[model samples]
Target: MRPKLLAAVLCLTLFGCASKQVVPTHNESRVQAEASLKAAESAGASRVPEAAQHMEFARQQIADAERLLVEGEQEAADMRFRQAEADADLALALARSIPLEREAQRATQQAEAARRSLQ
Candidate 1:
């Protein structure tokens, strides 16, 4: 009984010390950030001031992430990549909103004109 117990404890200790692979998030986040940036550009964020600012921020964050990756700071690199993706997404939204805003203003004017005619 004593021998079996000792063997069990030794096996448990060895298994606990076994190294496991650490999957890095840097690559995944980097891919997401790039995609977001492309979407923002396609939405014409470069032509919209507000969106352009966010898009620029996204680019900078991505650059930072890459630098961090080179430095072997996987966790920090992952964070920067997430930040970049967020900024790019915001830029895309803002770019899309510009055209929608114009349409809204046009509708408002048409409504006012119809109201005046009715009066």
Candidate 2:
């Protein structure tokens, strides 16, 4: 009886470890999206509109993922979550580039004016 009990305990422990290794895709996507959103927010405030939109979309995806996860459709949920994160990152990159682009344009204009004056 003691040996049987020990074997059961060992099996339970192994199962628990295995479960921990199986990270739900939705959770990973959610985390990545959140991180991207934070980066977008930090890059500049002018990107608020795009950032807000991305955040809203991400929230919706996360909600869907949660529902799917609850329904035991983990693989689908994970795919959606990854898509949400990609969308958020794209938005963030777009926002961060706006200011840089504007600066570049201004610099080019200034340089052109200087060249004209020199000529």
Best by TM-score: 1
Candidate 1 error regions (>4 Å): 1-24
lDDT of 1 by residue, 1-119 (tens): 99999999999988887855656577888999999999999989999999999999999999998999899999999999999999999999999998799899999999999999999
User: 66, model 2: CA deviation in Å?
Assistant: 2.6
Total backbone clashes of candidate 1, pairs 3 or more residues apart or in separate chains: 0
- Per-residue CA lDDT of model 2 for 65-111, tens digit only, reads 77888999988888878877776676677677766788999999999
TM-score of each: 0.74, 0.61
Model 2: per-residue Cα lDDT at residue 56: 66
lDDT of each model, Cα atoms only? 0.93, 0.75
